[model samples]
Target: MSPRPSSPTIPEGRDSDGVDFRNVVGILARRRNWVFGVPLALCALVVAYLLVAHPAYTGTAQVFVDPRDQYTPKDDPLQNSVPGDGLLLVESQLKIITSNEVLNRVIEQMNLQNDPEFNGERVGLGRLVKALIGLGKPEDRALVTLRNLRKKVTTRRIDRSFVIDILASADTAPRAAALANAVATSYLEEQAGANSAFQRRTSEAISAQLGKLRQEVKRGEEAVAAYKAANNLVGARSRMVSEQQLDEANTQLTNAKTRLADAQARVRLIETIEHGDAGLDAVPEAMQSAAIVQLRGRLADASREEAQLAQIDGPNHPALQAARAQVRDVQAAIQRELKTIARSVRNTYASERTNVQTLQANFDALKTQSQANEKLLVPLRELERKAESSRIVYESFLAKAKTAEERQGIDTTNIRLISRATTPENKSWPPAMIMLAAAIFAGLTIGIALALARDYFDRQDRGPEPDAVAEPDVPARAAAEPAPAFRPAVIAQHHAGRLSALSEDLLAAPQGHTMVLVQVQRAAWLDDVALQLARAVIANEMDVMLVDADLARHRTTSRLGFDKAPGLRDVMAGIAAINEVVQLHKPTAMRIVPVGLSAVAERDPRARQALSLAFRQLRDFDRVIVDGGEMGSTASEFGLYYLADEVVFLAQGPGGKSEDAAILVDLLKLRQVKARVVFVEPDVSVAA
Candidate 1:
């Protein structure tokens, strides 16, 4: 036989197989009445709400931000370091604006809590009902009141500017403006006062430090003065002059004493000559000269030796004896010579003695003068001490005076206000147009979803109702001839027997030769019937096979706890050989051959043609229970009706009075199917 042609492809835009934009438009057009009505009604409601809603006026004040306020300048002497951007200051200000301190002040100033309208005004019964239904809460009433008041008060940064816009709203415009202005003024005053306090404290601290510094300066000056006074430091020039005069006088006195001693020595020599030393002339000039020369040489040698031995020997060494003897000889010779000379020069000697006496008197006078000069040093030292004291006092007082002068200059001026708050003129709220547009869009989207969902759940098939015979695309040879009619008398007798006898008769059919047919009024009822029949057939102890003929909704395998298997559909399509697709249910002693398990067949036109071939291959089972599609469904009427030998129509008593059942019966008769209709009654006793 020639293979059947492939199923026709569903055209794009076709309503049956793809999204129908036209249907979508039609649904939307149909719902247009509600669409327009809902929005218009909502718009009216909004308008009514606005009309009844309390009128709120807003007032605003401009505040300039001072970023520098929270920071200390680098040059500021008293400032200490802190972290973060000065934005912290702005944040602090924001907190203060919303603080309980500010809020309480506003409440008290406006007498808001006591004002009935601003508190809890009477609410209508409609609002009460909405509140009970959770559409509203009583807390919302309080919030609304607060919001209404809040509307009279708002603070925002001005666009692209550091200034803040403080706005207020109220039932009365003036009050709203006033409240806003008041809050702004209060905040500004508070900030200004804080700044003033900070400045005052800083100034006071500086003042105290300055006072301490001044006292320190004074004490430092006094210390310097006392030090100078104690040290007796006269002016440098005066001290130098006095020291020069004292040195000059001492030099003169030393010179005078030297002359006086020279004169006295000469007189002593003259006296020795006059005392009978005329005989000294008898001595040899050479001897006298030699003696004097020797003594002088010896003394010179001894002094030189003594100087060299000063560190190692005493002045009394025996080496000095020759010098002493030589000195004595020289003296005796000098005395003799002097006596001889003196006899010849008595007048000269006497004159020498007078000069010596005069010289001694002058030496005494010089010594006295030196003593008097040394005495003057005490008074000069005293004057130096006094001068040093005065200089010290002057320096100390001068240093203190300079420090005090610097301290007194730290007064400065009071901190000044750099900016003032200004009242604002406009209100911000509602966003009516945007909200309405969003609502309309949401409503339409919801409406479309509901329509599609309704269509999806409806069970009616759309077109080309199921017919008795396969379509012309299927080969005639693949179609089965009508089954031979069974005697109604024989079936009725079998049905009237005891349930156990019926079971025995079914089981007695040759071990591998049995057939069970189940028909239902609709495709959805098959699962329950198939399960019941499957259980019953398995209980007969004959191997059973079940076939699902409902291509539109193939669920038999799933219900039998099998995943989709390539069964009857593949055999009919010639894609799979029969034995390969036929799955055996081992534990139950049953085999299940489901109809087309391919999800594709539901929309394929050749599905019925393929199903007819699948049913032809089912003769191998010992007993076959076919779960054909619903009697009224197209798949059963055209694809499965001729395949069954004996068919049973499943109904539910008077509940099966729908036109669907009547049409199914007529279709079965028209197809010449030898089927018996059975009504199922609910067993109340078993159900309970």
Candidate 2:
């Protein structure tokens, strides 16, 4: 057997089969017409459009958005529904300026439907073409005219302010200006009308409420009056008659108490004089007796006469005896008068006591009546308070109703036209300069894309070389040791079974060999190819190991439903023993290692270095088949290329010849790495 070539690494640009930027620039230069002409042609078209399109003149009018009567503590309900702050209010007002109400007014005022700019007049070649095609109709024209009129009217709000601009476009400058002014005027009028209507409604509501409140006040006043009458609480200035009566009763009670004490003292004094040893002469009653006084005076006179008689005549003389008798008679008369005085004093005491009892009784009865009246006054006073409150509420509502009625006829719109629209001097739509720049930019971009696409297709048509060579698909890696040159072993469809044919190619190689199975194009039956190869190995009665290296789409693992099973990632991360994760394919009894989700394992720098050891461990098996993901792009597959002894390319059919695989083959040949190809054709059977 010929000596195996050393594996090659990716080469620098000019020395290997790879696309270079210099070549891409050259291809663009050759197709200069496509790159430059497209942009110029597009710019010409933009000029043509500007010339043929009817110029639309635009006019603008400015208005303030402040609501009227800000100090009234009332809000415009319609305005309040819109947001209140900064951009939101501005945006809402902008919508209102373009509202149907305002626009319809503008449309009617300008008679835009009859205007040619809006009504679709047949002016140019396009109109003639449409007429020839039988596309233009009167009804369609009316609808289109209305739609165009609406589209021509636009509004914008000035930033950081409460100003909105109403803009209208028309065929003539004066017409556009008139339409704009009309729209602004109509909006202002509508706003004023709305405010007036709102106030009218508000006044109506307040009037209704005022009527109810008036009835309430009347009822409250009536209740207060009825309570006052029922309780007999007639008085001056909030004080009731019963309260004054109570005061009078208290004063009488105090006076009666004083009188009763005085009467009792007098009665006791009289009793002392009559029943005790006190003298009648010492008594005030005896001192005031007229009969007693007379008796005393007479006794004194008779005593003096008896003294004169005794001195001149005998003791038993008739004149002296008469004097003595006269004195005794006077003394007896004085005694009778004292008894009469005592009886009269007792009678006076009894009469005074009776008067005191009558006064006390009268005072007590008045006091009881006053206290009972006081209890009734509580609810009556409450009724009075309610009456006052209802009166106050009624007055307040009446005042508000009057205010509302006064404001009902007042228009409260603050929206004023700051600037009226004037005739536009120039057209607004189809800005010449901006359209030209945009056309140039867009044309350049499309032109460049087409140029690159054309170059790529041309390269593809040229195809790869007939002689196969191993090449690197990855970026060039620095050489550690010089590598030998190698030849490629290209495999095509054979009469033998593709699987059995692949098996023979491997069996013919040195024993216990490792190879990477890569598809020339993606999704070229990679899983089916891997399975068939495993079965071929099993048929030969040799143990084989299948390592699924495809992390993107784990076709091998999914087909066998071993998605969750531990496989390449687990082994690489040292989380599982190789034997534990390796599942045996029952049909072929082949050992298959699944590719699990091991992002951390693939990211580690040590994972690639550990591959040699992993391959050595699998030396016990007769063969190791690694599903080396995609051909050119996968970094893991590029690393696997160095670890495997040889590489096998699986092409789907005649259409499966990828330029990427060709480049990779050339890179492999430069490094002297053994590589081969296996073509898989559809609807054909092969033998072993």
Q: Best candidate, lDDT-wise?
A: 2
lDDT comparing candidate 2 with the true structure: 0.68
For model 1, the superposed segments whose C-alpha errors exceed 4 Å read 1-3, 12-16, 19-48, 69-85, 100-152, 158-161, 205-554, 564-688
Per residue, candidate 1 scores C-alpha lDDT tens digits across 80-148 of: 223454455555566666555565566667677666555655465556778788886455544555544
- Please tell me which predicted candidate would have the highest TM-score against the true structure: 2
Candidate 2 per-residue lDDT over residues 1-688, each given as its tens digit: 3344332343333222232333345556767888888889999999999988878899999998773333344544555443445466557777777777777676677676677777777477777887899986556655666677679889988877878999988777998898899989988877777777887787788778877887878887788788777767687648877667667766766766676676566557767766878866666766777777778788889888889888988899998898889989888888788777767766766776676677667767767777887798888778778878888888877776776777666665556899999999988977999998998899888888898788556535323433432111112333322222111111112212546667787777655678788765553233466666765677677778988877766666776667888887776666766677788766446688898656543335466545546766776677788887655433343266766777777765443244445456666666666676666543342321
Alpha-carbon shift of residue 210 in model 2 (angstroms): 5.9
TM per candidate: 0.38, 0.52
**Candidate 2 minimal-lDDT segment of 10 residues:** 486-495
> How many angstroms is residue 467 displaced in model 1 relative to the true structure, after the best TM-score fit?
35
**In model 1, where is the ten-residue run with the lowest total lDDT?**
679-688
